[model samples]
Target: MLHSRETYQPSPSFTQPEMITIILLYLLIALLASVVGSMAGLGGGIIIKPLLDFFNDYDLPTIGVLSAATVLAMATVSLIKLRISKVAIDRKNGFIIAFGSILGGFIGKWIFNFFVLEIGLEQLIGKIQASVLAILLLIIFIYIKFQKNMVTYQMKNKLGILLAGVLLGLIAAFLGIGGGPLNMALLIFFFSMDAKQASINSIYIIFFSQLSSLILVGTTTGFGSYDLSIIWYMILGGSIGGLIGSIFVQKLTSRRIERIFNIVIVIMILINIYNVVKG
Candidate 1:
């Protein structure tokens, strides 16, 4: 009973030419975001969301599709690299997170289409994302200030991992993130995992989440106005970036690398928050 004309909404910012330009720009952005994401466990989704929001006026559903696409592409590259290195993911935790994230992804897409989109909730979310990012940045700075040596500490807890995974699922669904920064924070704070382990595990988490989210998106709202032709471009760029990042990880000390990289993330989050609010 859905009327095609009734359901169709016009894009305010992205004309056909603009969209093509944005797609091309995304190829470069994907490379940079993937490298930083892989090296620091910061994630490409957060980077893409703001860009899409600023340039394309992408709604939440569109952000979800684009976010999922970025995660899928980047995770696939990371998965292949990890396989070559013989890294083993915590399968139990990954599966638990994936299960919850898949359900949340579906619910999130439904919520966007049925409610948020109609109510201009995407604009509201932009503000909230800014606030959340600011808070997260402050927390990171505080953690670094008070507990610089926490990197040497190890607090492995399987139960805690499961709980973090569930929370991550919810956050990812809401924010269009792959839950990398959130997961990285948990691994560093609660689990006390080192940078190398955290980075490797993050890729594992993204792999599962991406697989599940992709299916949810495909079955739900479909890819809103996406030109499927450029998927190969994203894949190619993301793979090269991921490979370079993984190599960079091996060259750096885990402690120094983690602390420095976390500082960068904290800064980026603050900037994103500022931009979203200013918009």
Candidate 2:
């Protein structure tokens, strides 16, 4: 069993060089993941969460917190870039969705705590998360592959949009993924947005949802037991990656973005599958 949150500390056995190497690795992962995630509207947590789980360096809660913080940074930077570029967002729907996401974030965190602290099934929860993520990724892959044949709606109902946001936030928070591809997929299907549009709006949604989730974590558990030394490195990487990705998104065609999104989905599915089996 993992140590309690009050007692757990990052392992201190690594030599100075080893610690530096690990920090560099963390930065690289955050950079790469954020770049691709920003381009594809994934918020990067989808990639970061699984990779961190694979590393087996920290407990699940710490990993979730770190991933959330990193993605929040990426989303914030990406959205700022978009705003500066004068990219228009659907403010009415966006704010409604964001509000719903805040509610869902709280509920999801509560559920996660229940499973980990009350049920005492940390390992089981990890495996379950991996398995579910893999399955969801597979479903998304198939949907995207055949989305050309699918019928999409341009929904304008405020209640429906709010509910959709809540669902997206709940899934993203519960899975510790920043609701990247899933957000894009929902936007495409429900909002009838094209690839580039979905990517931009998805980042907007991610910023609000991740920000709310992190606020909840900070005000409650306060990141006391986690190894937060590497967080600054990851945030820096995420910010740089977001800048690079925003530039690319502006240059790339929607078709190109969709292609990149498809490739990312495939890789994420494979990684989640590996995590599930390894667990």
Candidate 3:
């Protein structure tokens, strides 16, 4: 499951030169992944997991840690931009969902550490993860394309927002994803939020949830000893991508960006499924 030259601890068999090459690759992938994910409001989950799976021997919990680290950086950048841009967010709704997601993320970390580890549940979880990715990709594509006319939110959909928060939070914990995609979709489709507002609010929501997730995972999961440099590179690359994506988004239609995002997601998910099935 880990790379031969384990990222957390380099193997004696591999030279430093080889490790540097791997790190460079990781950086490149991070840039591309974040650009696609941030543009689409999916919080980078669709790409991060599969990329990690293919490149290293990271366990799920470690992936969770890395994911949290990267998302934290992106969220911080996004939050600062939103503040400067004076983007208005429905804080009442954003906070409520964030509260649920934060709690759910902690619970998720606990489940991953205690139950999944104790029962050796990685195999089952892997299969389920692959399946979920496939379904999510398909749904994202359909929602982005055909649902344009139907995609609208009602002011009265308060109950739906609460429900979405809890559900997405649970999923975030289990998958090490930021849960922004689902929440943003809900806000866009059910709350009548514009693209910019949804994006800004998602930044805050994901930030808090990831912070809470890190606390739980750190307390119980022990960091899995992955290379700290990988975390840094991922965050750095993701930040750069987020800045570019946010700027490009201001002048573009949501539908256009969504179409491009869906294509990348579908390809990644298909590759992920193929890997899981092969394994």
State every prediction's TM-score relative to the real structure: 0.82, 0.95, 0.85
Model 1 lDDT, residue 237, Cα: 66
Candidate 1 is scored at a TM of 0.82
Model 3 clash pairs are: 1-57, 2-57, 3-57, 153-190
What ranges in model 1 sit over 4 Å off? 1-6, 10-20, 103-114, 144-160, 224-232
Worst 10 residues of 1 by lDDT: 1-10
**What local lDDT score does residue 211 receive in model 3, on the 0 to 100 scale?**
81
Which residue window of length 10 is worst by lDDT in model 3?
2-11
Residue 99 of model 1: what lDDT? 64
What does candidate 1's lDDT look like per residue over 1-279, in tens digits?
Answer: 111324646345556897688677877877877887777666677566656565555555655666667767777777777778777666666666556556655555455454455555656766776567557666765664455565544445655555556667666666676777766666666656666677777777776676677776565545544444556566666777777776666667777667756676666666677666674
Cα RMSD to the true fold for all candidates: 3.4, 2.2, 4.2
Q: Rate the local accuracy (lDDT) of all candidates.
A: 0.65, 0.85, 0.68
The per-residue C-alpha lDDT of model 3 at residue 150 equals 76
CA displacement after TM-score superposition, residue 22 of candidate 2 (Å): 1.2
C-alpha RMSD between model 3 and the true structure = 4.2
- Ranked candidates, highest lDDT first: 2, 3, 1
Residue range 1-279, candidate 2, lDDT tens digits: 223566444434567897798799999999999999899888899999999999987778878888888898898898899899998787778788778887888788778867875676778889988999999888987887788899999888999988988888888888889888888888889888888998888889889989998888777667666677788999998999888888899999999999999998888888888998883
